[model samples]
Target chain A: MTPSREQKLWMYEKMLVSRRFEEAIETIYLEGKKPVFNMAKGPIPGEMHLSNGQEPCAVGVCAHLEPSDVVTATHRPHHQAIAKGIDLKRMAAEIFGKATGLSGGRGGHMHLFDPAVNFACSGIIAQGMGPAVGAALSRKMQGKPGVAIAYIGEGAVNQGAFHEALNLAAVWKLPVVFVVEDNAWGISVSKAASTAVPENHVRAEAYGMPGHLVRDNDPYEIFATAGKAIAAARNGEGPSLIEIETMRLAGHFMGDAETYRPKGEKDGLTLRDPISRMRARLIADGDADEATLDRIEEAAQAEVDEAIAFARNSPDPDPADALTSVFV
Target chain B: MTNTNPARANERKLTIARAMAEATAQQMRLDPTVFVMGEDIGEFGGIYGNTRGLIAEFGAERVRDTPISETAFIGAAVGAAQDGMRPIVELMFVDFFGVCFDAIYNLMAKNTYFAGGSFRVPMVLMTSTGGGYSDGGQHSQCVYGTFAHLPGMKVVAPSNAYDAKGLMTAAIRDDNPVVFMYHKGLQGMGWLGTVPGATNHVPEESYTVEIGKAAIARPGKDVTIVSLGIGVHQALEAAKRVAEHGIDAEVVDLRSLVPLDRETIRASVAKTGRLIVVDEDYHSYGVSGEVIASVVEHDLSVLKAAPVRIAYPDVPIPFARVMEQFCLPNADKIVAAIETMLGRQTVGEPS
Candidate 1:
């Protein structure tokens, strides 16, 4: 479906928010690395897997989901969390390890959970797939209209949980949409070298579900496919698999040297960046003006700045409360 | 004459499997959000008949029979629980946990704590455990110690029909993730010979047996016998045999492994001055060892002698009946351990 000018502006704003938030995190991470690099000495004192060039995948898929619809994401989840409407202030506080964080300073960047929005992320590879199936099963059992979205990296499609969750969702006809953000690398190993099949979407046919591949970093194309799959799932047509081909603009982790990447690959990836491509398309089609797009970017940066400030102002959790929350 | 059977009306003799089914069915009926999903759990009534007649009553939507995928269903149960649905996911055997340990340990158990108490996984992972009918190593393991060792899970192993019903009820209502393990031998199946008293009087109305409590099967003063699941029956049998020789033995059935009733163990051991832990799990670094350490930590002076433990040797369960019987903790082994602890002549070797 062709999105209106307003919808295009909203998408641009959301993607900009994600990009600026990630950039802020990266800057803080590097600042912590200055002088002497100790992982524990950072404002975000954990392994940060920033989604630098994968904003389209999260924004496209999550745009179709309501606040009640559930979404589970992988370790690299800031983009998905932002797209799924998680409070940026709380999420920033969580990443900063503050008392007012999403998990009250318990869960760091990789383990963000917002029950109000029914959003969760797991550090284990393809681990969120199982819970996504479960949320879908819950919706189906309760006769609710909400569907669940499970986001996994292309590298994690080969994990056992991925296959099991797909088979279960297919057989049970659960309303879950499995999104594979194929950025072409499982850390250092290329997807072609590690995954059994070159195209991960082909594996969906084995489970008797429709699979589609949305090539390139086009948010509109992603939105179209994701919208169809999500609509079909909500209509009780069973699960669908969507693999969106994107690129990783930065290293897998903040400190990753990225020696495995081919020479000049980093420089070449900048030409196809999703955010810039979407901005050009919006301006060319008269859907948005350059001034409007620039204003959106400025507002996004300001919002991210406020989030960082909130996180910095938040208090650290009490050391004595460590033993609490182990159980209900 | 009008039939006035208050005794039968108030309570009924139910097998462990039947009691478990009744408890789950009652929960499903009372809570619209509670549902069960597992292999052969729907139309087939479960392999052990623990979920018999549930599908017919609750329909296929709630009483679901899933493919042999533990990770998916268990993970789904966690998700559903997080989404406000109380789900009971069954893994046919605890041995099958290898395929889905990541979901159980990383997600179900740790999610609440990891989420900073913002989320609660109110789910029950019901699975069959233990072996006596030569089910081999894969099918016959009381892995309660393994689950209890994990931080997030609440492990419950009921020894009789009464506790089976009550504990199942409690596990369903509990806000945390519960690993409800049922001993296959204690299920009281006619085809599979049951341990004595595995089937007991269960109340008609719903009730809860506290998750972190211990029950005294038989009270005595000479020695304290600590056990759970089928080991409880074996300890009681040994208690009877030891009483014949003027040695009074007390049997403590530990219904819950995680919230272990250390106070009961301390009070009993203080009175008896001797302790023997009977466990079907591996000997080293298990419940038996944990019991010993708990008693020692609480008050070492209360022990009249170094406590003895009758547990399965550190090895996989053998397939051969003779070898399996030899390795498993039985009444004879308990009796012999007690005799040895009392500085008396030991009984014959385990047959």
Candidate 2:
């Protein structure tokens, strides 16, 4: 369960990359639309959902995924998309609506699809559950290797799709794992207001599957829990559900004024930022020295910068080309 | 008959239920990638007998009897299809679609398009439809029109045992997401009773009837009787009944609804100069309207008399057998509608 020196460094670097990418997206997403707050006027128009502080959830689970393994993610998908090896330049370009994008600008940030790394996502909550279960079933049926990891938010726990998918995965004994990233906020609503249960993982017991709850948004804890579940699936064992407590460092969407938030509630989330915690842990755990960690952080930010620059420089798609991909 | 399997060489007359199960068994034998799943589909062989003897032949892993969780299993079929397996997942009944339509329309239908063709969902969503035995509102329905109305889905339903086997074969072989809807009334299941003549001589071989094509069940020059599913049976009977009135009626079986046989419909209407659509689905905003619109859109001048539609009334099918029968389209109703369309019925005559 312990992360090796290299694994810790890898997780730390990935967290940094995810953080910087979200920071860049958040900035440019609000560029032209600010002050006047016109959502359609930005370089990245329409909705921008960023997974800022929830870096550990994606990094830990994806660390277990192979190139052939499938990963279906939620709307705030850049983190998982990056962690699962989506082409950075193309993904950034997709968010920018450029022709060089992953789906040729058809699917924006929320609807990212990268079959190269076997990654797909959508704006709908709990929609990924079905496809992930299916992918697991397919691989098993064909005697092919590789499991599927489906990521959803705690809010999705209440959805029938989520319940149905979990029960199917368990009953079929498919090679799949359901990861619930409990950020505790579904837009303005909190888990206390929306969820009837105190935890989503225990609900997996209702379906005869083992469920684990990872506290503190810790990457190492997530990695250990996800490692066991993923290995079990790969070894022909049944599926498992993991609920990781995480934080939303940004608003649900860019330009969302959190006026509904109680006073000082927003400030508390910044104190538990996973990236900052990971960097300190990496130093304290003797995985890296300050100099080594500094180099990794700088390199990660440089990669993010290149991706953002590539997105900005990419060409816009022709309006006529919009009708091409509706069918095969 | 060209029989691929030597054992069934002498068997010519197969019911729609047997034809479907045989088609599935043949496909499974031909391709190991194809499998069947749904509640009661395994040992119970499905309520409508669509998967009869599948589990005994294919085993549990390949022919799974899933929990009554439509959303998960259907979604898994879509995922499995992308992973290079052809999965024929049953929704159990068309009425049960409400519990799992998101997986059907969103993932199964739109994923390939959303992925820009990077993924191919070679999955077949097969389910039982139609209502003649008073299964109540929740159990009986021919809602293939809803799937046909959506984009990125191939919707097909066969009227007889011969087409049932062929269409099921074709649907399994197609790369896109195909909704293979079958009518319960025409399945020839002894318990529910079958539409007479719904069972016919079907070859015991793996063959695919072309999707999006209509069949001329009967030909006439005076008027066209356009319908599908159980309506095809009713239309044929109506055509025979109307012949006594000296009004020859053509019968067109619309096998596929999404890639609708608009060409066949238009051609039949043109030849007959009159049209009467009989459908088991609801009247407004359904396949019946789509059939009429396709004809008029291509050429409005082809019709001599105003077209008429004999469809289920826009109401929940009542529980009582008599009340449900009142809402259903039948041969007599189709005959009455044809009489009115051809200007032969007197207002006082019993329809």
Candidate 3:
């Protein structure tokens, strides 16, 4: 299906917005003028898997999915959440644990959920697969072709749930696509330390399913890979697993000691970053110019600034809220 | 004396598998939102045929099977519950619990509170438990105790076909997460017939035994035998044998473990003054401990004999039949414990 050029542009625009949002957050977080009202913003001291370099995976996959198609994301799901149409104001509020956050200030960065937008985010590593499988099962039962996408990290491949979910999805022919964002590092430990086979995609073969790798830095490649897998799943061909290869531009988290990463490695990968590639493609192809790119950046900046201001002004959740919702 | 029950008269018998299948079918028919999922529940009629004929009756959508991923499907039930569908997830056996306990404890149990009062998960987890047949240690376990240890989870351990159908119906209709434990031994033990003297009449009709309610299976003034799950049958048999010894023991069947029937226990203990709590779980923090604690905490004066609790020894269940027999509490053990509490020396003890 040839998507309208306008739709493609919108996808590109949303991707740019997500990238700029991260860039803007990193800037404000570094400057000490934190967007989070509660003396916080960006990643904590240890490790934050910044999506700055890997914007295309989020852009291409989200481009094919509608607002109603449920998505389950891992810890580094800022781009997924933003691309899926979560309000920046609420997302920033949620990151700050402000009362106005999407998760009602309970879930910080890893646990972002906008059920209204069919997105449930979790910080627990490899736990998203189960919920994503369940979401796909629910969609299938409802007779909706709503394919669920689970955005995982290469680190999560070793988790038992990752294997269990794939086995079940393949057996039941559930409408789910498992996307392993193989950034080659599980925090400080590289993929070599985690799985025997460094290529995480091959693990899917053991479960009797096709697995392949996509150039994680290319938006076009990510879109095609995710699109094919998602289509196969929605068409009732069961589930497929995709391992996307990219590199983390920042530390595992914010302020992470980069001792584990070879010196100048992040800087080197930053040269072939996905966001920069998309930007170059848009401009070189005359799809968008420097002025238009400037306008998009300005709009993203204004929106992010407004969200920070809102999060700053918003109140914290009441302590009494802790006792609520124990049971329905 | 606790109202009319035809099954008790030895006129009816039905397999636990048949009882559960009937319950699942009736629930799906009664509520459009109810569905079932497990490993091979669809094309294979479940590992035990408990879900037989369901896939055909409800089609693949309602009676779907899944990969052997307990954590995913179980957690999926939580997500599906949040969106307004009542799901009954089968874990095949209680031993597979390690793969899926987090979804029950962390996610489904506390989702409402974690969501800051914005959401709640309404799902039923139906799984087989207890050890008698040589299904090995892994397949033979009573993990309902672990579930009873957690708060916000309602555990139903029905001992017979009647309670199986009744309690399961309630669990399905429940608004919170309910863990329904099915004892492999008691499937065909309770309801002996499908109708009055028909020999196969277990009610095709549906009913619910409210949570936190206990049924007094027998009334006596000497001692109260508070038991649940397959242990209820053991307690009943012991009561009958104790009657021969001139000891009138009252039996209170605690069908639900979490919202325990403390009032029934208190009332029985108040009258009997001696309590014998029997559970298939191990001796530590199992349902027996909870029952004994509730009796002591609420009605301390009712104790006549240090509240005898008969339970399996604290150890991983051994695979051998003889070792399993030694590990589990049986009718003879319950009867002996009652005799000991009554100042009469019982079996397995030297004077």
TM-score of model number 1: 0.97
**What C-alpha lDDT, on a 0 to 100 scale, does residue B202 get in candidate 1?**
85
DockQ of 2: 0.69
TM-score of each prediction:
0.97, 0.95, 0.86
Candidate 3 lDDT by residue in tens digits, A30-121: 55424433334333221245686666777778888988787888789888888888878888877767778876766667767676777776
Native contacts recovered, each model: 0.85, 0.64, 0.51
lDDT of each: 0.90, 0.88, 0.77
The residue ranges of model 1 lying beyond 4 angstroms of the native Cα positions read B1-11, B346-351
Instruction: For model 3 chain B, give the 10-residue run with minimal summed lDDT.
Output: B191-200
Residue A294's lDDT in candidate 3: 75
> How far does residue A100 in candidate 3 sit from its true spot (Å)?
3.8
Candidate with top lDDT is 1
Q: Chain B, TM-score, each prediction?
A: 0.95, 0.95, 0.91
The sequence of per-residue lDDT tens digits that candidate 1 reaches over residues B1-351 is 011112343467889999999999999989998899999999889888899999999999999989888988899999999998999989999999999999999999999987999899999999999987898899999877898888998999988888899999999999999999999999987788887688878888899988888888888999999998999989988888877777899999888998888888888999999999999988888999999899998899999999999988989999999999999999988898888889896454333
Residue A89: error of model 1 in Å? 0.9
TM-score of chain A of 3: 0.90
Candidate 1: residue pairs that collide: A134-B76
